[model samples]
Target: MGTIKDDASLVEQALLQDEESKRYTGDGSVDFKGRPVLKQNTGTWKACPFILGSECCERLAGYGIGINLVSYLTNKLHEGNVSAARTVSTWTGTYFITPLIGAVLADAYWGRYWTIAGFSIIYFIGMCILTLSASIPALRPVECLGSICPPATPTQYVVFFLGLYLIALGTGGIKACASPFGADQFDDTDSEERIKKGSFFNWFFFFVNTGALVSFTFIVWIQDNAGWGLGFGIPTLFMGLSIGCFFLGTPLYRFQKPGESPITRLCQVVIASVRKRDLVVPEDSSLLYETPNKSFVLEGSRKLEHSEELR
Candidate 1:
């Protein structure tokens, strides 16, 4: 039989390769290789377990590091309560703030999958550094004796914090992308998949708290009873597992293409508004710039009606 072309727009170009028999997903998502994906084979709940698994371990790993940090700083590093508290607060802020950088990169350039994968390596390296800092004698401060404790040397401070900040950078990318990446597995255009997407979020949060719970309860106890080396080491190992789990589910994952930078879009809006500051408001909402087509002006998005409240 002669091959059929995907181009079927009447009376022309029918002599190409046969059309794909697969029922492609309607959500405009593609497989990891950028080809159309079969709806039944990829994504949905099948891919969620891996994502959830990764999230759980990652959250566990993150909280494992953070929960006992104040104690480590004061007791092990010989930092004063005030200094330790300040350091913890600053590190926490940096950890959260770095997500903005991840978000921009995911949206503008790297796409979510690559961003998560790339940052996870950084996170793992940081965890390893932290583990070594705890396990190696030279990396950690000398043990305290009685009432008088020597301060942590400059070398000790450098090694510990280098690991700490690297984790901040790694977790930033994961935090920014993981949830949305999970959501991408479900097709928004399909009614069934859309409902499933809601359920996905519910399970996603459940796993998140599950991880946190384990870290606070089990990991905290380990740090207290066990040596610092083992305590930090457990989380580091889990962080590695987190990376493994994510990669394990790579084949089942659906990917969305990165679009224009949101920051750039925001700037364009502000500039447009400033230039149009003197223009009178139109009485009819239909007078606003909006296309009536099924597709939106923005790629991979639906058209939204203009709202008068925003004006």
Candidate 2:
């Protein structure tokens, strides 16, 4: 492969390759490594379906959990009417905040794959807790360990809250990084592959929504009819499947090493600009211009005038 300089060179290389393959009719003047290039079979689009399937599964998992979450907290957990609102709010906040933590951890400590896997384990534990809470209602009296116990209190609410927080954290990590990670699979230097990458995001989201719709309609309905355990369990199952699917594509997936952010680069530029002696003015009355003409002078002119005054 030839070294790529810019977009124009990439496009030209693509067109030249196409011409050599007889996929396009043109004079084959372009040479690769001093030899007349012949057309090579680029192969069929195999990975597109896998990408779409993964996205669909992800959306389904998200939608299923989201649509049923509030009802699960209030109804299944049997949180009192007043406390239900606060409980739901807490759940929502944790879900949103975990992503920021996940992103930071992913960039600084865990690579994307490992971060996703670790969080997924935490998510599964949360699901198990939710299931246990729903199953064992009598455990509610043990709140805070050694606190006064109210007889016959339900523990479902406590379990549900803990579970929801875990799921939120896992979702935050996966949502922040997966798309960009997936996009890294395509080689952008190749024009044909680059065009395919542009279309990848569109299909990625489409499958996600499809999964969500299925999860919402089916998972919620199952929970309503069968039991809370089955309802929460359904999402757990799908999430597990989604994780497996992600790993299946691991061989084909491209991994990009994390690097410093643009903000860091910008701050460096600003610090360097500020540190130059010529860029900073001294805090002295003697250096101040005393005349009206000096007030309207440009920076270079002021410097020249100050030098002249010194002479």
Candidate 3:
């Protein structure tokens, strides 16, 4: 904020435009078209405690599982070190990379709020299934045959991977929306609110580390000393609490409409340029067909026809 100067960018103006569109009703909810009317709340530091607290718990729940994943695979699953490492790597890679897909879904279709909410359920379900697989006799390895450990049966494989990949998908959605959603709670127009929003990111990272720390220490200990079931179960409980806290803050959240997808805009640009390639290039910028309204057109971009007739 300090270093950057000059005029505000088009995205900033678009953000302001979004803030302006929020129609606050006398009722608890605000008027938004696609989803159910969102609970109206001012985006302020005062109202952001719920979002922060929810994030802490969500991190704790999510981190608890991954931190000790190698141990669980090696000890309980009776997997060799190399195999366990590979499995953990694949699982984590999937968890992180799927966010790109989720971001498109969030920005292009579902708004951030609903994307987070919907995915939180999927995450919770994954946690439950993972816990169940860890605990149940049939889901994990049965008896060790002499020196070599038996591989997981087809059913066990299905149960375990289902839990693992659901987690991947769910975490992807959460990662895409959570931070931006948190920042969305602040009114960017106000100097004070904008500062608070910037300050919030610093605190958010702090809390995130706190979650990872606790999971690595306490949660891992429980799994090692007590049982895998108890370890995995604790995170599931925290995840539920995380979801509950998120919903509880509905009245305090600063909701926004989903932004347009860059991919879609780019594709539109390409299509329009290619279709008009052989035609004479217009000398005047005004000659290009454009919509007057800023609401629908890409910010700081040449407005393309909204109609498919551009083809």
> Against the true structure, what is each candidate's TM-score?
0.89, 0.64, 0.75
- What local distance difference test score does each model get? 0.89, 0.59, 0.77
lDDT of 3 at 236: 91
lDDT tens digits, residues 1-311, model 3?
Answer: 73353345666888887766553321122223323343244555655676777788888888898888988888778888999999999999999998897788877777778898999899999999999999999999976768778878888878888888888888888888888888776654346666877888998888788878889899989989989899999999998998998888776566566657868878988998899889987797664655566434432122333465645
* lDDT tens digits, residue span 156-182, model 1: 899999999999999989999999999
What are the candidates' C-alpha RMSDs? 4.7, 14.6, 10.4
Q: What TM-score does prediction 3 earn?
A: 0.75
How close to the true structure is residue 190 of candidate 3, measured as C-alpha lDDT? 45
If ranked by lDDT, best first, what sequence of candidates would result?
1, 3, 2
Error of 3 at 177 (Å): 0.5
Clashing pairs in 1: none
lDDT of 2 by residue, 1-311 (tens): 34555777989999998766664212221121223322231111343454456556656766666676666555544445567677667767777788887776665555555676677678767766766666664633333335443333434445556776777877877777767555544544357656877777887787777887788788889878887667767777777777777666554444444444435546887997778748556687555545545332321011223455555
Which residue pairs clash in candidate 2? 21-39, 56-207, 59-212, 60-211, 60-212
Candidate 3 local distance difference test against the native: 0.77
> What TM-score number comes out for model 2?
0.64
